[model samples]
Target: MLTKRIIPCLDIKNGRTVKGVNFVDLRDAGDPVVLAKQYAELGADELVFLDIAATLENRKTMHKMVLQVAEQVNIPFTVGGGISSVEDVDALLHCGADKVSINSSAVKRPDLINELSDKFGSQCIVVAIDAKQVEGEWLVHLAGGTIPTKINLFDWAIEVEQRGAGEILFTSMDHDGTKAGFANQALAKLSDIVNIPIIASGGAGTIQHFSDTFIEGKADAALAASVFHFGEIPIAELKKELKQQEIPVRI
Candidate 1:
C-alpha cells in the first residue's frame, strides 16, 4: 500500500502566514519561509503554500514570497492561488515549486487544466477544489470560497482527472478550521468516483482525525493548517500515531 502523506498547509496573506476558521476571522501565524523550513525539518511529506487572498484580490501570487519559502524547504512544494495560465505555472516552477495548484482559474477556464498538464505534465498539476455542502449537495466554490458555482464536487473531481490533473486537493469549506474532523463521507464518495489521488483538507483536529482520513476518508494525503501552525499537533507525533493505527505512513 502507498504510504499516506501528511502535508502542512501555509495559507499566505499579505506575504504572511495566516490561519482562519471557516475561511474567515484570520489571524497571523508566522513567516512563510520560517514555517516552510520548520515543516520540512519536522518530516512533512509535502508542503502546500496557498496565497489565500490572491484570487479574491485579483492579483497573482507573490513570486518573491514563493521563492523565499521555496528556498527553505526541500520537500515537494505545491503553490497555488491566482495561477491562471501556462506562463504562470512555468514561472512558479522556475521559482522552485514542484507542483502548481489551480482553483478559481480552472473553474473559469476548464481548458487551463489541459494547458497546464500539456505544458508541465499531469504530475505537476494539482487541481484544488474549495467545496461547501449546501442543501445536501457539495457545491464547488471559487474566488477563495466566496463565489458559488453550479459545479458539483464529484463531477469536477472526475472532470479534472479526465483533463489530466495529477491530483485533487479537496478543501471542505464547511469543515475548514472547525477542528472537528475531515469530511470522510464526502472524501469516500470522491475516492469511489475518481481514479486520481485525493488530498483531504480542512477540519483536522486530532491524531485520530489523520488516521481516520486515511482509513475512512480513503485519502492519499491529509492536509491541515491551524492544528499544525498552532502546535496543537506535531507532525512527527501525528505520523507515529498513524503508523500505530496500521495506516501506512512515513515515520
Candidate 2:
C-alpha cells in the first residue's frame, strides 16, 4: 500500500503566511519561510506554499519568497497561485518547487494542463479544484474562491485527469478552516473516478479527521492549513497515531 501523506499548507498573501475561515477574514500565521522549515523539520511528508492572493491580485507567485522557503526545507515542496502558463511553471520549478499547482488558470484554459504535463511531466503538475456545495450541487469556484462557476466539481476532476494532470488537490470551500472534518464524500467520489492521487484539503480539525479522510474518503494524502499552522495538530504526533491505527505513513 502507498503511504498516506500529511502535508502542511502555507497560504500566502502579501508575502506573509495567513489563514482564514472559508477563505475570508485572513489572519497572520507566520513567515512562509519559517513555517516551511518548521514543518519540514517536524516530519511533514510535503509542504505546500500557496500564494493565495496571486490570482486575485493578477500576478505571478513570488519567486523570491518561494526560493527563501525552498532553501529552508528538504522535503518535497509544491507551489501554487497565479500559475498560468509553461513559463510560470518553469519559473517556479527553477525556484525549487518540486511540483506546481494550477487552479483558476487550468479552468480558464484547460489546455494548460496538457501543456504543462507534457513539458514538465505529469509528476510535476497538480491541478487544484476549489468548490462548494450549493443547493445540493457541488460547483467549482475560481480566483481564490471569490467567483462562482457553473462547473460541476466531479466533472471537472475527471477532465483534469484526462488532460494528464498527475494529481488533484481538492479543497472544499464549505469545509475550509472549519476544522470539523474533511469533505470525505466528495473526496471518495473523486478517488473513485480518477486514478491519480487525491490530496484532501479543508476542515481538518483533529487527528481522527486525518484518518477519516484516508480510510473513509480513500484519499492518498490529506492537506491542512490552520490545524497545522496554529499548532492544533503536530505532524509527528499525528503520524504516530495514524501508524497505531494501521494507516501506512512514513514516520
Candidate 3:
C-alpha cells in the first residue's frame, strides 16, 4: 500500500483562511500564506488551498493571493474554488499549484473532468465532491456546498473516475466542522468503488480521527481544517501517531 498522506486544508474566503462547523459560522483562522508556510514546515505531505466561496459568489479565484501562498510553500499544493474551465486550471497551475481541484463546475459540467484529464492528464484532475446526507441519501452539492443536486454521491464518483479524473477530494458537508469524526461510511463506499486515490475531508477533530479515516474510511489521504488550523493537532505529531498505529505514512 502507498503511504497515507496527511494534508492540511486552507479554506480561503476573501483572501483569508477560515474554518467553520457544518459549513456555517465561518471564522478567520489565519492568513493563507502564513498558514501554508507553517503547514509545509510541519511536514504535511501536501496542502490544499480552497477558495471556498469563489464559485458561489460568481467570481474567479483570488489568484494573486494564491500566487503568494504557492511561492511561500515548499510542498505540493492543490488549489480549487471557482475553477470552472481549462483556462482556470491553466492559470492556477501557472500560479504554482501542483494540482487543480474542481467541485461545483464538475457537477454541472461532468464533461469538464474528461476534458481536463485529456488535456492535463488524470493526475492533474482532482474531482472535489462536496456531499451532504439528507433523508438517508448522500446528495452532491454545488457552489461551495450551498446548493444541492439530484445526483447521488456514489454514482457521481463512479462517473468521475470513468471520465478519467485522477482522484477524488470528498468532503462531507454534513460532518464538516462537526469535529466529531470523519464521515467514514461515505468514504468507505467511495474508496471501495473508485480505484483512484481518495482524500477524505471534514469532521477531523482529533488524532484518532485521522487514524480512523485511513483504517476505517479506507482513504489514501486525510484532509482537515480546524484541528490543524488552530494548533489542535501538529501535522508532524499527527503523522507520527498514524505511523505508530501502523498506517503507512510519511513522517
Candidate 4:
C-alpha cells in the first residue's frame, strides 16, 4: 500500500512563521528555522516553507533562512514564493530545497512549469494552486490568494500535470485557516483529473480530517499549519490514529 504523507506548512513573512484565518489578519507564530527543525524532529513527512511576502515584497525566498532550515532538518523540505524562472528553481535547489513550489509564476507563465520539470525533473517541481470559489465556480487565485484568476481549477490542475508537475498542492482559500475540514469535493474532482500526487491543504482540524482527506478525497497527502504548530495535533500520534482507521500511513 502507498503510504500517505502529512506535511507541515510554514507561511513566512518578514522572517517569522505566521498563520491566519481565511488568509487574513496574519499573526506571528515563531521563527521559521526554529519551528522547521522541531517539525522535522517530530517526524513530519515533509515541510513547506513559503515566503508569503516574497512576491508582494518583490523579493525571492530568504536564501539565508532556507539554507539554515535545510541544514537543520533531515526531512525533505520544499520552498516557494516568488519563484518565476528556471533560474529561480535552480537557486532554491542549490539552497538545499528538495523541491521547489511555483504558484503565481506558473499561472503567469505556464511554460515555466515545463521548463523547470525538464531542468530539475518532475519530482523537484511542485505546482501549488491557491484556489477559491467565486460565484459558485471554483477559480484559481494567485498572489497569496488575493487575486482571482479566470482559469478553472480543474483545467489548470490537468495542465500542470501535463507539464510534468510531480505534485499538486491544492489549497482552498475559503477553507484556509478555517479548521473545518479539507475541500474534499474540489479535491476529489481534481484527483480524478490529474495523475500527479495531490496534497490537500487548508481546513485541517483533527486526525479524522486527515483521514477523510486521503480516504474519501483521494488525496495523496494532507498539509496543515496551526494544528501542528500549536500542539493541537502531533504527527506521530496522528499517524497512529490514521493507521487505526485503516488509512495508509508511513507509521
Against the hidden true structure, what lDDT does model 2 obtain? 0.87
Q: Each model's C-alpha lDDT?
A: 0.86, 0.87, 0.84, 0.86
**How far is each candidate from the true structure, as Cα RMSD in Å?**
3.9, 3.9, 4.0, 3.9
The residue pairs that clash in candidate 1, if any, are none
Better of 2 and 4 by lDDT: 2
Worst 10 residues of 4 by lDDT: 20-29
Write down the TM-score for model 4: 0.91
* Model 3 misplaced regions, further than 4 Å: 19-29, 55-61
Summarize candidate 3's per-residue lDDT along 127-224 as a digit string, tens digits.
99999988999999987679989999999999999999999999999989899899999999999998999999989999999999999999999998
Tell me the spans in candidate 1 whose CA falls farther than 4 Å from its real position.
Answer: 20-29, 55-61
**Clashing pairs in model 3, backbone N/Cα/C closer than 3 A:** 21-177, 22-176
lDDT of 3 at 112: 96
Question: How many times do residue backbones clash in model 4?
Answer: 0
- What's the TM-score of each model vs. the native? 0.91, 0.91, 0.90, 0.91
Clashing pairs in 2: none
Question: Can you give the lDDT of residue 179 in candidate 4?
Answer: 91
RMSD of 3: 4.0
